[model samples]
Target: MSASLLAILVTSVLLAAVARRYDLSSLLFLVVAGLTVGLIPGADHISGIELDPDLVLYVLLPPLLWSAGLESSYVSLRENTRSIGLLAIGLPLATTAAVGFVAYRTVPELTLAAAFVLGAIVAPPDAVSASAVGRRLGLPRRTMTLLGGESLLNDATALTAYKVALAAAIGASTSLRAGLETFLVAALAGVLVGFALGKIVVFIRSRLDDPLAESAIGLVAPFLIYLVAEQVEGSGVLAVVVAALIAGQRHSTAGYAARLQDRAVWKAVQLVLESFAFLMIGLQLPAAVEGLKGTSAALIVTSALAVFATVIAVRLAWVYAFAYLPRLVPRIRSTEPPPVPGQVFVVSWAGMRGVVSLAAAFGVPLTTLSGQLFPGRPQLIFLTFVVVVGTLLLHGLTLPWLIRRLDGLGDQQRADLLAAAAAQDRAAQAAADRLDELLSDASTDVDARAADVLRAWNQRRRQTAWERIDDEGVESPMATFRELRLEMLAAERRAFLADRDLGRIDDEVLRAMLYGLDLEEAVLNRG
Candidate 1:
């Protein structure tokens, strides 16, 4: 990387870290900081940093999608498929049409095609912020799952629409029927490509014992799947998401070492990429503004704010419509419970646009096929910038307060914990049964003390899970055990390090012992 880019990354990361320290939205913080810096005198170098559209779509997006997919709960996703599908596919298309129509009517200079391009640009909400806020607020599992699943697939919807709209803007023939066909083909091809690659990766990783090699493959897989799918005229976003979901489903079968390394590596990668992307969203503000030189300031402000309002309003309507309208059917009402108004409202308000919108705007063609300047290209880009930053500041800042006000979800969260405790109890019982079966075998030579230790461990695991649902003030037995066990583990770690320092233990032996201690601590913390 160039020194300038490295500096930008460091600066962005620092701003994000500060935001995180104070429980602020890091993405919003970075964007605001970037905008502030961009406006400073002699900060042209920062604001002038140009990014290729392909860099955002091809290079930056895939890994982020992959990371989210890997971390997603397959069970939750399956259960909430209908909700996710509505938000991912339907919402994007609706927003594209709604925003496109609004933009076309609002900006006299903008062609219908170019307006739709702008619409597609800002249509998809980057759920990174929504997911972060939802997680921090301890939103119910189903809500989080819907957010995760929507984030994974919504990009595909927006980008596919973007392609069709862009083709029209550049003077290519496109009709509603053709656009629908294109979307269907892209979605199908992407899923097939991603599924095939995902299975291949899983099969290879499952057979491999090398953590470093597995990690390398995991890192490369996203980009590879994206490129291959796009090469076949499919939605690269869908391909990456599909491959990630497939790979995530098999994640537990991987070696412990690979899983540990993956957690550290992917976490760092996500932080760096997300920070840089959010900062760039802000840093590009000057260029976006510079593009509209000589344009009426009043016109610019009115158009931008109008588009922003439209974006927010459309999401609210779409979410609420989907949440309730389907349940009006007698059959549907009988099959599914009514949607929680609080959850639906939270989902609606969490629609913050991100780097992708800016990237799409920046990618717009400067000139049409007839060699005429693409109508309102500069204005559209500026409008997109405004919408992104405006939504970020508006929604990102208020979501926490909104979630706090609508606090009825606490009961649902507690219910989820109770369900988890029940599941843990069954799993622990099964483990104990398997242990007994192993011990009963004549070929097994385990010590009686070792057998007792295993049995106690299983019982403790069950108790720990159940303890989570106990009264908050209660000092449960499992909690006490965890506290004491953690202290003991810390002591063991210090002893191991002391032995290593005194040259009494080999480095490899120390690492092995430390790994064991770390795994135990991880399990305890997880419980």
Candidate 2:
């Protein structure tokens, strides 16, 4: 097991590094790595590895979700709430219904319930893919923000609907009324559970004296949030997301060391787990196709294509309606600006299915209540796998091209920069005003050195935007000072290495000196 993990880590790191350099899809590269490595003869140690659906849902998903929620902008999400709501809830429902209907029609052997299950599985676009590609392409802030927020929340909707459909498929009674009630109750309870857990985590972190221990609590927070919600039969996905959002907002109040520890640990965790999950997906091909030797290749291909089309078509139609329909109403039109058509098309095509769909596919039960094999179980898995591959390849690879071709890049980012500059200008002026008030006061305690540093920071912050726009673009004095400090640190680093090579300093002493130089360099370089 350790060897297998080491092998996966090495492969993921190599592919991820190459992808980063070339600006290719890292997630796709990982998938390719998995598939390519699977082809190697006598590599059963990795190709033979198996993953359970519960292991994915329970063990892997929470942390990934938490990291996403923590990084996302709460204020930006709130601003795009209407559009996000339509995409998250309405779009998934439409895709599920359309795909389910197509599946039922294309494969006569599939029952409506089974078709719906497959539909639910493929409904939500992968959050990892959207953010990874969107951010790299320098997408407008609003478009990227919308994609991030929608991907973060849509899992709850799709997964809840998946359960309801699965229950029906398994011979349990299901109704529109009961399904709606269950969805509402589960969603509300999940939020409440997350809110409660968020507070608990905050309290725990406050009491923990060690930064590592506090970071550990942050790491486990997602799991606790998810498990607690699941224990009460609520939506675990939402629980993790809500708790993460709350915890992230409170992070500002945390000790600097605790925050640094949490960020460092979570960064490593995200890379390791997310890479493994995507790679593990490709490794599932052999298992996904098991018990299907008798199935016709043609049937699988046709059904997969049908399902894929349904997923893509429904997304485009829904986004079009949502984007344009509001413009026709006076009140709505005045409230929110309609989206650019080109950008709308890009967002619609960004709906690439990923790990969540595959996990849910493997989770499908083999038998119903009557001890009979579940209808179309193998076909369902095959079709699910196909949709993931199809969308990931088709939409994921091409969205960047379409954005460039259509000139769909919006000005949200430019506007945001302008707003940020204005805000910074005001902040700097306020600090200046306060400093004046302090200097004017007869009885006020002020440290000269500290006050000078504070004043410099305020001035630098205010001038940064203006300096960037100037033709010369020369570095500020503060920046130049930091650059010189970095050079001095590098000199120290070289001297330590030279002493170690001459045997004047032991390896341990050299390492300790290097560490100090590194920390000092970090501050200067970061500045």
Candidate 3:
């Protein structure tokens, strides 16, 4: 294998192992590992292995973002729409303005347009990073929906604004009216294209008998919609979002087989894509640092801190102001869900930058309208890298601790409610069991065989009884069964490890065995 490929494989394994052991986000480990590798003499070659930014952005991001959007419950999003709107649309604009003002003032050589470009590049939070961390933290579904929705919409808005800013930097005059008109047209065009493409895919999916082939189409849908949308000068982000949403909605409603296959395929695809994205993110750090050569360390540090502070401060202000202000008023309050202050705070802090920002920053044109090199391109890229890494590490590491401190731990009441519901379901099963038995004992026994099977199921569904117990009660049959399963798992793991150490079983075989054992243990514990 080529060194780059080898590096990726080795780094991936190492990061995965470390992340699992330490209970850390895999993204964090992947990035840190990439940086370490990049610092090595020959590792810079890995940075030179470039792919097209458009391919990564328009092609890759849409599916990933769309997947996140599809997974988001529309009901939750509707509940938090106002807060999401304020954060996604309102916060980005506010942050851009704040950063633009500061950048233009601090860097006298940089034009106002250039300042805005910088702001726009850093404005949108990364949906992938936020989702990965948030899910692990057990954030409320509404909070996840708001964060996902905001991140999805903001990418398009920020990118659009960035384009305008870039044009202005090259001395192209832009009218607000023209910008608005363009945005509306582009958004509408994207929606139309997305719907059209989605319908075609849905038609194909419906007719396709093979689950694998149908899933393959679903995987390719985002890239296809994105490319088509971009060709028509539409919002590729919006197109992808709409396409994924349409596919997900139609996925289950289409039929049982389509739903089963699509769900399985999409879940696997999501895991692979997410892993690749984060690993790539880690590998880019050395390149970013190298791009900052000759720039004053102090200046870069100051600018990064200033930009980070501006981004965070602006978001906090926007969330608090917009989300709470409506509640204080009677007239507009009727329209929206009352924002949860804690959730808003969490969302504000979850603004970690990732692939989109990196791609956009790097995609900054090398030459202006007059063919002059774009001013401060390298510095801008480096600063953007700083913000992405800083926020990811800082927030990702501290978030769990913060949740605990804020008493955002798993809600016991919610868990209890679910448990109670489960108990009620068990009771219903018991009643159904007696009914089946009564019927089974009767002379009219045409479905007696089915009833017998139903009774067996009810026996399995018996309600778990919890009672104050002495030592005798503590060592129940279930507990004894669990102890035996644990012993079996330990023995199996030992055998696998011993074989692996002796080279009789390869790592893959060993890993598979261990995974199987782990799964069995999980099932046993659940029982």
TM-score of each: 0.94, 0.89, 0.80
Candidate 2, 295: how far from true, in Å? 2.3
Candidate that beats the other on TM-score, 1 or 3, i.e. the better one? 1
Error (Å) of candidate 3 at residue 256 is 4.9
Residue 317 shift from truth in candidate 2, angstroms: 0.8
lDDT of every model, 2 decimals:
0.89, 0.83, 0.73
Q: Which stretches in model 2 have alpha-carbon errors above 4 Å?
A: 1-6, 41-45, 207-210, 411-421, 434-458, 468-482, 492-527
Candidate number achieving the greatest lDDT relative to the actual structure: 1
Runs of candidate 3 exceeding 4 Å displacement: 1-10, 48-51, 254-260, 291-293, 331-339, 408-449, 458-527
lDDT of 2 by residue, 1-527 (tens): 77886787677777777887897778887887777666777877887576667778887899999989888888999899989999998888888899999999887667999999999999989867877766656678888888888888899999999999999999999899989988998999999999899888878888777998888788888988899999998999999988888888878888877887788888889877777777877776766777578878888778878888888889989988889988898998898866877778878888888888989998989899888898888888878878887788788788867776777585554555677778879988998999979977889878889789988877876776454343456677656766777888888888889999999999999888887787667655541
lDDT of 3 by residue, 461-509 (tens): 3432221122345676556656886998899899889999999989998
**Which has the better TM-score: candidate 1, or candidate 2?**
1
Return the lDDT, model 3, position 206. 84
